[model samples]
Target: MHFELGFVLLFSIATAVAIAARYFKFPYTVALVVAGLTLGVVHAFEPPHLTKDLLFAILLPGLIFEAAFHVEFRKFWKNKLAIHALAIPGVVAAVGVTALILSPVVGGLDSVRDFGFIHALVFASVIVSTDPIAVVGLFKALGAPKRLAILVEGESLLNDGTAVVLFTLIVAVAGGAHFTVGGATMDFIRVAGVGALIGGGIGFAISQVIQRVDDAMVEITLTVIAAYGSFVVAEHFHYSGVIATVVAGMLCGNWAASTSMSPSTRVAVESFWEYLAFALNSVVFLLIGLEVQLGSLLASWRPILLAYVAVVAGRAVVVYGVSALLRFTPERMPWSWSAVLTWSGLRGAISMVLVLGLPEGFAHRELLVNMTFGVVVLSIIVQGLTMAPLLRRLGVSGLKDVYQEKYELARGRVGAIHAALTALEALRRTRDIPADVVEQLERDYQQKAAAAEQELSALKQQTNRFHEEEHQEGVRRMLIVEKDALLKAYQRGVIGKEAFEHLVAELDERLAKVKDPEGHVPLEQSSPSLPDAA
Candidate 1:
């Protein structure tokens, strides 16, 4: 297919799949992959291959930035120990364990007995990065605790950089580069550290620029530069581009978007990125399906299955190990989260792209590709299909009831009606409409607004869940106000340093409990005492 025409076709198919997925209540990304696979099998016009160049140069930075942009650094930092442990060392351990387990099993197979530890290690590294795109949305939809979602998302965001850096190192070692434990450790630190520095510098610069501009388009363009520019510069210096992009995105989203950009501009920028993410995700998932050769995959089903099992086992061990260690910390989570975390490790585009980028003459290249592709497909289809049920089984899914939806609709209607009334009043003042007509319209809207508000109130009365939600919302707002006041008081020297820190810490704990109500004691039940400044 012509390059231009291929994209047109892909987007059209994605549009159709999106509509169908929504109608049938299916996971849209999964459906796209399935659509791509079906179309490929039926010899639907050949789509452009999902090349490493295409992914690394274009799709990756945008996707990473978009995801990272929305991640509040405060939330990410709260579980820093857990997120870092799982993403950095946890990923490395998982890779090593996967290799150790897979090498002997695959060596025992008569078909490819030569698949050694290094090849297994390489494959493990490729697949260790979790793509929780499918599951994160489900978490929100199912009302899972926000902290749990943060852990999953924050880990994924950081691990992508770790996995990519590890993959590069392993591939280098495989290609005859000298390897040493100390050297590799230092190299990883330097690459990641320098990338972070580069990203922070670029992000800070862009944020400065954004604060000086009020135009939405200008601020949005600056963010785009921060995202791609950081990646390109870091990669050009042989550093970790993924890490650079992620850091840049986090700063821009949490710092620039919040403090610098006006509300309207922020909304515009956010909307643009959201649509871009959806578009990029659509193409990537669809291409993942088209890339797989069913016949080849079927022939390699034995290794694929074994590899998949190894990956899962490896992840499970790491998750449980991490969970055990976390039990002593403030960040400790329920043991059941280990199972969810392990199962959520579904490999996606990064694995596929890295494997494909391997040199043509690399040992067992085709087999490695086949194994990576097969495992990616299996993980997405199998795990994605079952995540909701898994959440239900674990009792982690919160408020998966109809009342939540009805409450949301009623609340939205009330807000919309109020906005409409505001607009009507503005028109009544400016337009030459008759007084009686204006009065009639005003009465009509008032009645509609009252009806919507009453409906919302009744729904809140109908369920404690609604009441709890409203209470939590109100509490969160008040806590934020208190925190803001505390910050200003400390800054103005109205409060002592120790007292400010103590009060702020208390407020943060309360906020955390409010956000993850299922995991912590309710604020109502906790000691609510505050100490005075000395």
Candidate 2:
């Protein structure tokens, strides 16, 4: 197929898959993978081979930035020890165990027995990095605990960088580059440390410029530059571009988003990144399916099966071992959480990119690639499909009941009515709308608000028959969301300043009543307020 036609075909498939995913309540990433696999199996059209440059240089920065940008910095800090343990040491442990277990098996295979330990380690490094896109999507859809989601997401972002560093070092050993423990440690620190420093520096500089500007378009453009620019710059200097991009994104999200950009600019920047991430993810996952070589994979089933088992075992060892060591901490993790963590560590695009980037004539390259593909496919399909049910089995399922949805809807209705009243008042004051129309609108809004308020009151009473704590948490989340909506409306000029302040004050007061004296809501609370509208 011609390049233009191929691009259009792939995009059209992505669009169809997205719609189907929504309709079926399927995880979007899994759906894309399945769609790609179906097309590949049917030989509908061959996708162009994915290059390492295309993935790391072009697609990866945006995905990493968007994920890191949305990470709750406060929550991340709270779980810093656990996240770091998993992301840094956890990666090392997983890699070592996988390589150790698979080395002997690879030695026995006739096609690639000579590849030996270092080659096995290289393959291990490729698959050890967990991609949390599928897992996190399910977490959001199922309303898992906020802290749990944060830990998983934070760890995944960091581990990708770690895995990449390890893969690079192992590849060096396989390619006859000298390796020593001391040298490796220093190299790891330099790659990660420098990347972080550069990313932070670039992010801070961009934020300073953003604070001085009010144009949404320019601000959005600057953020786009920051994402891709930081990654490219870090890579140019041989630093870990993944880490640099992640740090830059976090700084932009937590600092620039709140302090530097205007509300409108912030919203635009967020929306732009969100769309970019979605598009890139769509293409990446779909291509994963189309790129699968089933015959090669089937031929390597023995090693593929063995590697899958090893990967799972490695994950279990890391998760359980880390949680055990951290049991003495103030915030002790539950065993159920450890189990979830182990199962949720699905590998994806990064693994494929690393495998595909292996030098030609490298020992067992084809076999290793096939095995990595099998593992990735299995992880996305099997683990992704089972996560929700597993959450339910563990009794940590965050699914909200129908009454809770109705209550939330009622609260939203009240907020919407208030916003309409505020807009009507503004119009009347300016005489942009006639007094009669404004009065009539006010009456209509008032009636709707009263009805919604009454319904909410009844729902509040109904909560007494259910889990009081859960119900209260839901109410608190609803209030937070309503406050955010009010702020956005004011920012967008849909609500008057006075009304926005009033509504926000009311929400804050309500939130205060529900929260503990320390102002910390339980981490187990579900359905956090939506992102503050720019």
Candidate 3:
């Protein structure tokens, strides 16, 4: 196929699968993968040849940036311990265990009989990093806890760099590069540290530049430069590009987004990145499906099945074991959270990229690639499909938070009524309004106020029956919204800086209290009045 035609077909497939995903409430990436597989099976069109430069240099940076940009910095910090534990050591453990378990069986498989522990380790390293796109998408759609999502996402973002480094080092060892524990450790540290420093420096520089510019287009363009440029620059110096991209993204998201860019510019930048991620993800997952060698996969079915079991087992050990170890820490993870984390360790594009990059004559390269593809498929199809149901079973599904939504709606109605009444009173005093007009407006406002009051009262009564945790979550969410509104009001010059700062501080205090279970106070119990909108 002509390059343009192939691009168009891929995009068209992405669009169709996206629509189908939405219509059927399926995870978008999972749907795309399935669609790609279906197309491949029927030999509908040639899979677009995804080059390493295209995948890593072009597509990956945007996806990483988008994920890192949206991560809630506070939540990420709160869960940093668990996230790092699961990402760094967790990745290593998964790789090691996979190699150990798969090594003995390698000699029994004709395709991989020549492969040994070192080769198996290289394969394990390729597949160890979990792909956050599909699982995180499902988590968002299912309304999983914000912290849970952050943990999963933060781990994935960080682990990709670690996995890539490990893969590189292992591949080098397999190809006659000298290896020592001390040397490997130093190399890992150097790569990760350098990548982070470069990324942070680039991010901070771009953020500073962005603050001096108010044009949304310029600001968005600067961000684009930061994402791709940081990755490319770091990679050129033999640093971990994935780490660089992630750090740059996190900086842009938490710092530049709030402090440097105007609200409009921030929104535009975010929307652009969001769309970029969606488009890239669509292409990546679809290509994963289209590029699968079904015959090779079938030929290696025995080893692939064994690898799948090993992968799952590795994930379970990491999640359950880490959670257990962290049980006494501030970041102690719940067993339910660990369960979701375990099942969500889905492999995708990164694994495929690593395996495909293997040397053409490398022993077991084809077998490893097919097995990695099989594991990715199983993870996306089986685990992705069941994530929502699992959340529901564990009682953490977003549906359980309906009370919080109802409370917000009720509060919005009350606030709107108040605003309308205040506006009506101000207009009556300032303008030459007729008595009839004033009376009708006053009556309308009064009825709406009454209805809003009733609704708010009913919602409060209903929500009072919620479990303590749920009630606290509702209070925390309300406080966050209130703080956000105050900040926006300040940004728009609707409120003075002093008032905004004071109000936000007050809200923060309340938020802290609500978050603290020991001294928790419900919003209604603590303060019946909303923050002054003036």
Local distance difference test, per candidate? 0.89, 0.85, 0.83
The residue-by-residue lDDT of candidate 2 on 148-188, one tens digit each, is: 88888999999999999999999998889998999999999
Better of 1 and 2 by lDDT: 1
lDDT of 1 at 508: 74
Task: Mark the regions of model 3 whose C-alpha exceeds 4 Å error after superposition.
Answer: 401-404, 412-454, 466-534
For model 2, what is the error of residue 263's alpha carbon versus the real structure, in angstroms, after optimal superposition?
3.0
TM-score for each candidate, following the candidate numbering = 0.85, 0.83, 0.82
- Give the clash count for each candidate: 0, 0, 0
Error of 1 at 145 (Å): 1.9
What candidate 2 gets wrong by more than 4 Å, as runs, is 110-112, 411-451, 465-467, 470-534
lDDT of 3 by residue, 1-534 (tens): 887898899998899888888888878888888888888999998767666877987788998988999887876776777889998888888889889888888666765556689878988999999886777776666667777878889999999999999999999999999999999999999999999999999999999998788999999899999999999999999999999999999898999889988777888988898889888988899898888878778888888888888888888988898999887665775688889898888888888888889999987777778888898888888888888889889966665467777776877888988988887888888877886798898998899889888877777776555356667877877876787677677667798767766776687577656754322122322222344445
Q: Could you tell me how far off, in angstroms, the CA of residue 347 lies in candidate 2 after the best superposition? A: 0.8
Global CA lDDT computed for model 3 = 0.83
Model 1 lDDT tens row, 444-508: 98999999999999988887877887788789878878887886777777988788778877887
Question: Which scores greater on TM-score, model 1 or model 3?
Answer: 1
Ranking by lDDT: 1, 2, 3
Clashing pairs in 2: none
